[model samples]
Target: MTQPSDYREHLMAAALFIAGRRWPVFPLRPGGKRPALHGEASCPRTGPCADGHRKWEERATTDPDRVRRAWSAGAFNIGLATGPAGLLVIDLDVPKDNTDAPDGAANFRALCERHGQPVPTTRTVRTAGGGTHLYFTAPASCRLHNTAGKLAPLVDTRAWGGYVVAAGSVIGGLPYETVGPALVHPLPGWLQFLLIPPHPVVRARAAAALRNAPAYARAALCNEEENVRNAPVGCRNATLLRAARALGRLVASGDLSRSAVETALRRAGQTAGLRDYECRSTITSALNWSIAHNSGRGAA
Candidate 1:
């Protein structure tokens, strides 16, 4: 007959595995996401807490002995403190309460396509709740904070002040498991741009150029902007690509300035709820490709 699950042993091994990676690990309440660390009010102010109450972030440790001792206390789930671990984790969550909200992974994929980029391949965990967590190394000297709905709908991030449930955690009879490479990749520059504040120098200059452009180029830009703004959810990226390609030909033919065309498409993409990085990447790429392949130079 098959042996029953050994809760403590299993959890201890899990905690050890993560700790071995040098990531500081803490505990979550078994079967839930809440931190299992002692609260300030309940602090006995003894042992490690002799001076004062130590929150989870302070108590998180990469030591195997501490992990084993902590796991011996109960069937605790692993919580990787991202900041201490030097990680930035992207949480692609499922729709809440069975609502009809868009799926996080799909939205993220669309966001990638809109920017002419492929999804970054990195360390990944499939959560028990049927979502995914992608892990990336945080940039040195940058203290990032958690962001909600910043990248896309259902796409959240955890860094300095947050933690992620690690593989080997369980909830509702499902285990969080590794589904990708063992190595965590450095965060991509494009993604970093999306997370940070944008500089307005290019956009300001692009607008000025558009004001002085010939009427035909201006009219063409107006038509393309409308197309992007009115594009439905599934068609937005394709529409933006097409418009960029068409305008790129104009730039090649000396009918419009590159920056002017780019500025118009960028605003139109953002109006359709695309992220800033996505708009810039897509427009720039399409323009480059179209300009290079322009056969009907000055035909218009």
Candidate 2:
């Protein structure tokens, strides 16, 4: 049986090992995955925490001295900051319950088969719960973000704003084990295509009715659709709201049928990269408010 001290020593060494490979690692709770850092509210307003409560990702360090100092404090697990490390890890997970559906690995395999390509080997880790983590080097030009089941059923990707439990980290008495070579290859082109955000299809089938509306309504439709599609990442919801409210007047005045406007706007919202639920709720609420405020049965 390993002694507690010995386990901790090994974990410290493991932290140094990954740091040597340029992965910025932060401390997690010993034998668990949660970051062991102090929260923002508990800040003493001194040291590095003095400036602000830096998240584990912000504080994740590649410096050997810091790694040694942090690990010397406790038998903490390792949380590799994926974004800072320039990693894109595709996490293949097992089903939560007993089900006949294919597990993540099999589904990923099927995805590869459909593309007529083999799984690209990289730095892989077998997670504690029998899942697989395939590590790849993110492209220099593209900044990928984490996604849940975006690639395939049960297959997720962690990039910016996420971290993965590093090898030698223990969870539920099972250590995350490295199963593949150390070399991290460039992301496979096919996989990259799947991970990249789809370009907005400015004129999808649902937006076909945009052409069928009256000249004024068509002009409104085109202007609002362009606004939604061109809206920057942070301003998407607000732009959608404004677009919905602007078009809602035409809908209320009976110049445009409610169904046609709603349908076109929904399509426009989606192509703007808003999620389905966000599109529905924002459009519905804004349109309702505009209709309630505007009084007309036909165009003025």
Task: Report lDDT (CA) for all predictions.
Answer: 0.86, 0.84
How high is each candidate's TM-score? 0.68, 0.68
Global CA lDDT computed for model 2: 0.84
lDDT of 1 by residue, 1-300 (tens): 111267667778889999999999998998788899879999999977999988888889999989988999988888999989999999999997898778889888988886678989999999988999999999885677798877888899999889999998888778889985778999998788778654488778887888887898889999999999989998998999999998988888777888888878988998998866668777878999999999575565
At residue 251, candidate 1 shows an lDDT of 89
Runs in model 1 lying further than 4 Å from the true structure:
1-4, 197-300
Q: Model 2: per-residue lDDT, tens digit, 1-300?
A: 345668788899999999999999999999888899998888776777777778888899999999999999999999999999999999999999978789999988877875679978998999999999999999888899999876677889989999999998877778898985977899998777667773445334435555566898888887888889888999999999998999999887766666666676767777878764457667888899999888664445
RMSD of 2: 11.5
Report the number of the highest-lDDT candidate.
1
Candidate 2 clashing pairs, residues 3+ apart or interchain: none
TM for candidate 1 is: 0.68
